[model samples]
Target chain A: MKARDLMRRDLTSVEPDTLVHEAVYIMEQSGLSTLPVVDEEGKLVGIITEHDLIQAALPEYFEMLHSVTFLPNLNQIQKRLKEMAFKPVSEYMKEVFSVHLDDEDLHIADLLIRKRLKQIPVVDGEGHLVGVIRRIDILSRLIR
Target chain B: MILTVTLNPTLDKFYWVEKLPLSLERVEEEILIRAYKSWGSAGGKGINVSVFLACMGVETVAMGFLAGHTGQIILRDLLEKGVTANFVWIEGENRTNVTIIEKGKEYHPVKIHEEGPRIPTHAQELFLKKYRRMLKRAEYVVLAGAIPPGIPETAYRELALEAKEAGVKAVVHAGRRALWEAVKTGPFFVKPDVREELVVGDMPVRTEEEIISAGKKAIEYGCSACLISHHVTGDILITPEGIWEYEIGVPPTAFKNLVGADDALVGGIIYKLLQGEEIPEAVRYGMAAGAASLEVEAKMCLSPAAIEQEMKSIKMEFKEPL
Candidate 1:
């Protein structure tokens, strides 16, 4: 089956300029890990993922210090969250990857396996999001 | 203290735009109107519940999983509100959720959500350890919202069972598979939104009767009580005594945003329950809190007077089967 066959059509998306918290709520409610960022015309311009958000939340030395101690400073965490919380999603969103509708399922599966991605958004030739294919979709339906 | 569990907590952002230029225009020529107001707060079902509870003068503790930078935002937000934060620190970053509201779009706001960090097994174990410690003081525990990745769907069930083992009453406000699993653990109460479905329940609940029937079945399945919301149809509260029906007529809508309404409803119920009110009065208070939620933009707390006034309009009926 093509990627479109197994893709989810009903989508939840946001404009890039949308503030950070609004975008976060949309993703949380939709239960999507990644959101395809679109312009007003619904054409994909960029994409945001949980990784991008987590990166935004973390300080520069987060990875270096995460293993150092389980009890990180509470004051520092709160201060950073307050500072980054109001920023626009455009500031934190990544120009990440997307798949085309006509791409072969095997090709898409290769991308997923190579990248270890959970889901990839699908777009038409016009760059309009048609659907999304998740790794779970592929595993549940195609991976004999 | 009332403890709330948000397995997938998030950083919530709200943007209010006067007019969004939907059409493609020359960037040099078009004067685009961007957002005039934006609000930032911690976001999660459990966090929102704690926010509401704290606003209503209830002592609430916001707990669950947090990772990376966004988790800090959640902690700060909760601490700022004076809600206790007892979260299990994780290795991944918490997600950021955004909502974009245009002037004309009252009900349909643009929402973008990021899936939260996957819970490593070690982190999950740490959370259980924390939960055990917190349960010693927690009289009421609310296990709300989604179960993050890398965690089994039975996560809520196990948490509810743990709360029960600690002699704490568990309240669930969730949807679909998570709600199904939570109900099986025999929570004190379960509230399911009709717009969402309990897929594990295997019932396509639509009308009032369907909603009631579903609640009845949920009680039979295991939970002590169930509240099924038929969105526009009606809301049914099923318990061992009988079914308490509440029809929330057209909300007293001064302004409408559905974002925190469920949290408000659940918070209201918990608020009255903490005050030692009977089930009917507490549900009535909950109905008013929910209706009052529509009157304002998402506020940290609903006004007590507004809830009292809105309670005047809501008609709650108790139907005890003979």
Candidate 2:
């Protein structure tokens, strides 16, 4: 079927500059690994997945604590946490792997199979964000 | 630890034909029939994602509502794929999705979705309780797909809040009220396609610059990053650091079935995260996985080898918007 038929009209999205913690919450609530990053105009721009957020949150340094016989280094762990806390998702987000609307549903399917993506954005002719087609959506269609 | 919840799951039925006539005519006994049939298990978004993750060798748990003969099928499929599943038993059929493929030189498949059985209030409550318990053990909780009819839109929101309180990351892959409500909980990731965004009156996001701006706005609404999965152009990712874009070009092979591509993407991202790959690397893997899924028929996700092969040839360009 065409993308318009298979795509999900309702969607959850986020804009850039969103706090890493807040994005984490949205992902938890929605059960989505990736979110469409858009502009004030709602145009499709980039995508941020759970991997990106996790990478952004990775600690930059490890702290070394007072030497205890076999205990792990508390100071190093603290240092790492501090560095990670300061890091932003922007430093880790992927800048690519997005799809557009106007492209055929067949093309989209091919992209998904070739790219192995779970979700593909449906943008309007102007490249504005429109709908989303998830592998689940396609699977739902297949089973029905 | 990514936890996916599948209240109901099922095996997908795929029927292939040379072409779908508006009306079917009976063929004579002498005439030969040309068609193909295939089956794969799928139900909620969570299960689909888990299947992909398992294929990619990512450790994951698939939980949710289950019952009836169809539920057995789902369990069998999960076991076959080596995915860990923990489902609460209930009454009713698990549900099914049908795919009709019109096979010419090119195959065109039409998907018909079946609404699952209504989830009783008590069962829903029990599932929620179980989910809350599971959330504590997970680093990431994925609440995927549409909640059965009779379920409240606020269900995802409540679950998300619970996860957050427990210091777990939440990922929501839902639509409409469910999606809007979940956003208030401040999830780590929100994946919305263009159509879903437009339905929410959050459209007009065109161009890379516009998408970046929108991603920033979503973060203001309590999202860590916004991943816009476009159909035609590519993808737009907005995070606290900055905005980035990836354009998915045409695939090398012809279209077979569009099913399971997104699940492949999810699987790819989760695999990378578990492996400690950075976001950019994860995106590449996700893109490759999605592309590979497109090449296969039915709802089956592509193999890792296929994904890796595609990853090597795929190229993505990054540019700073003016």
Candidate 3:
């Protein structure tokens, strides 16, 4: 089946001007860990994933830490989060890798496995967002 | 930011067909009716208002209940129009309201609307929580359209009251019980839906005198302003200061579609209000937006230039209430 056939078209997207807090609320409500950031022209500009938000909230020297428990207190992390909460998503949103509607399911599955992505945004010929294809969607469709 | 609530939203699908058969007599045989053109957009009274406001560069967030596959299409369209979505996902499917326009009969399109999904108790609670959070950032909140099943009719009242507590101006663009309920909370503005009924509760708005009386009654109920439709090309606005008549100089025959004209009017007014324009001037811009929408094939007048041009043909006259 084509990506269009198995894609979950019900995903909600965020705009670039959307605040980080608002984006988090939408993600929580929709049960989505990643949200495609779309611009006014309906083009997919970026994506806000759980990992991206975590990186923004974490200290700059987080990767250098021996362990997460090595942190003295969460005050540093809390302050970072509060400061980033009101900022626009565009500040922290990362570039998104996408697939077209006509892309073969096997190619999408391969990309998901190689890239370790949970979901890939689907765009039309003009790069307008169509929907998204999750790893589970392809697996379930293939199994069926 | 302007926040809009549409309890019952739909995916408005417009199809241009050569003809619409009165009946399908052959039940056993397969029949095919082809459409030459088709368009779909997010629709609901408040949703339409949000879309128009977004197009005008006003920050707007649309809050409502969305469900199933139909909800997906609605969300995509909303994002495309630049309106932020903060809807609660519920069980069942969102509605698909179809408008079939026959060739040369563009003025009179056949509309078929489905009653949308019922809002469960949990969904209602979740929506209120989200609404309160959104209210903190909203300068104005618009409660519009019909109240869907499983949701209380007093929902708008509760919301308007909360907005009042938050110091956010509330605009109620609904009719019947929903209008009456929200009016009691003393909204910033109330525009009664006169399409289904010519009354705000028991108040008759069929005649000019009666329309003024209805508007007065709502104002007496604590609303700042009350706007009622007078005719196809005219509407009457009543506020504490005085009454004003808005009329577009163009003939009614110039209208091609009247679907989202009222929404455009409300949105235009809010857009101007956000720009610090007074109520009268804002309403004038709104009337022009409605007139512009009337002349277009699309549901709304998307071009700011078109609305500006239509303003030249709109005339606003003040009057003493009878």
Candidate 4:
């Protein structure tokens, strides 16, 4: 099977200027962990995932705390989240990583496993977004 | 893509009522009235222009500050109408302009325009950043309409200058301070909004001579051309080379709604320009578009066919060389 056979065409995507809060709302409603970010021409540029959103709520230096027990106050996290809500998705979207439709299903599954990605965007030869294939899609094929 | 900016956008709500009470005599009573028909749409000079352009199958992106629930409605409307959205989200509710048209007074609709949200410093910064990025793909950037609260008076000046830097042609459709600021940047064209006050910048535009002088002043300020609305049925275009008058055969009484006529004119001109037409011919098409919108009740007459039909009656006459 090829990636095209497993990819879902109807997907929720966002523009770079979409507010973080609105992006999160779309993600929740669509039940998707990630959203592809496209430009006005509908060309894929980046992706925003749940991990990126949670990371936006944490401070830059939080990772360097060496797993200390004493955590940052809730107020501080709330304040950071408030600021992030108004910022555009461009600030939080991850670097683009996509697979072409002609790519083999095995190759996509291997990349997904190695990269530990929940979903991978499917693009055409010209880099325009065509669809997205999720890890669950590959796993469900065995049951079917 | 044509990028149109409406810094202060509105959701226009229009109602067709049988009659509107002239006097509310009792202060304690909550008077109730019913409307036979009602409609709402995304509004703002730039948005109106975008709607018109989209109807003509032109790719246009509308950018500005949008806020609250009303902003969502406006964005949805723009998307449904085929105009790409790139608005910066801000805090506060977008204003809604209400118009009540009585059965016999369709020509004299009572309009109440609200003041929209105040843009904070951060939102303004974000908008400029997005604007610069979008300018990369735009053929022309149209700066139209009123400047909202908390925005600098030099907003149009800065935007026009940025468009110039980006090598994109800029068309400024504004009035008063915004018009004055943009005129200094030598935009491709300048259309002064003289609806509220018959004035452009500090000059009075009430008389034909004053309008000509004001247009000349704008030309002196570095604008390539200045188009001023002379009356309901005509407009005057002044360039460094010569002046031309554009008039439609329709009378004022023939207009169903004059609200979005100016925006259609600007949008029509840009649409024609994108089709590789010259400035004179584009302005003629734009006049026809304005006349077409005047005959309809919708914010803009969205049919290119209608605009073409109206174009047949447009009279363009060259007055004299400047």
TM-score of each: 0.65, 0.63, 0.71, 0.78
lDDT of 3 by residue, B1-322 (tens): 8999999999888888999775879988777879998888999999999999989888788999988778877887887677877777776889988988877676677889898899988678767866786787789999999889898889999999999999999999998898898898889999999888888868889889998998888888888888899987889999988899999976765767768999999999999999999888899999999989988879999899999999999999999752
lDDT of 3 by residue, A1-144 (tens): 787676665436777987898788767656689999877655789999988988889887887883668788989888998999999999999988899989998899999999899999998797866678889888887788
- What is the lDDT, from 0 to 100, of the residue B116 in candidate 4? 96
Runs in model 1 lying further than 4 Å from the true structure: A1-144, B20-33, B198-200, B232-234, B249-253, B320-322
Backbone clashes in model 4, listed as residue pairs: none
Which residue segments of model 4 deviate by more than 4 Å?
A: A1-45, A55-144, B25-29
The candidate scoring highest on lDDT is: 3
TM-score of chain B taken alone, candidate 4: 0.96
lDDT tens string, model 4, B1-322? 8999999999999888888987988878987779998899999999999899888888778888788889878876876687766666676789999988887676688999998999988778767876887787789999999899999888999999999999999999988888888888888899999988888888888777888898898788777789998987889998898788999988877877778899999999998889899777899999999999989988888888999999999999989999
How would the candidate models be sorted by lDDT, starting from the highest?
3, 4, 1, 2
| Candidate 2 TM-score, C-alpha based | 0.63
- The total number of steric clashes, by the backbone 3 Å criterion, in model 4 comes to 0
Looking at model 4, residue B151 earns an lDDT score of 94
Q: Give the TM-score of candidate 1.
A: 0.65
Question: Which ranges in model 3 have alpha carbons more than 4 Å from their true place?
Answer: A1-144, B21-33
Cα RMSDs of all predictions? 21.4, 21.6, 11.8, 7.1
Query: In model 4, how large is the Cα lDDT of residue B115?
Result: 88
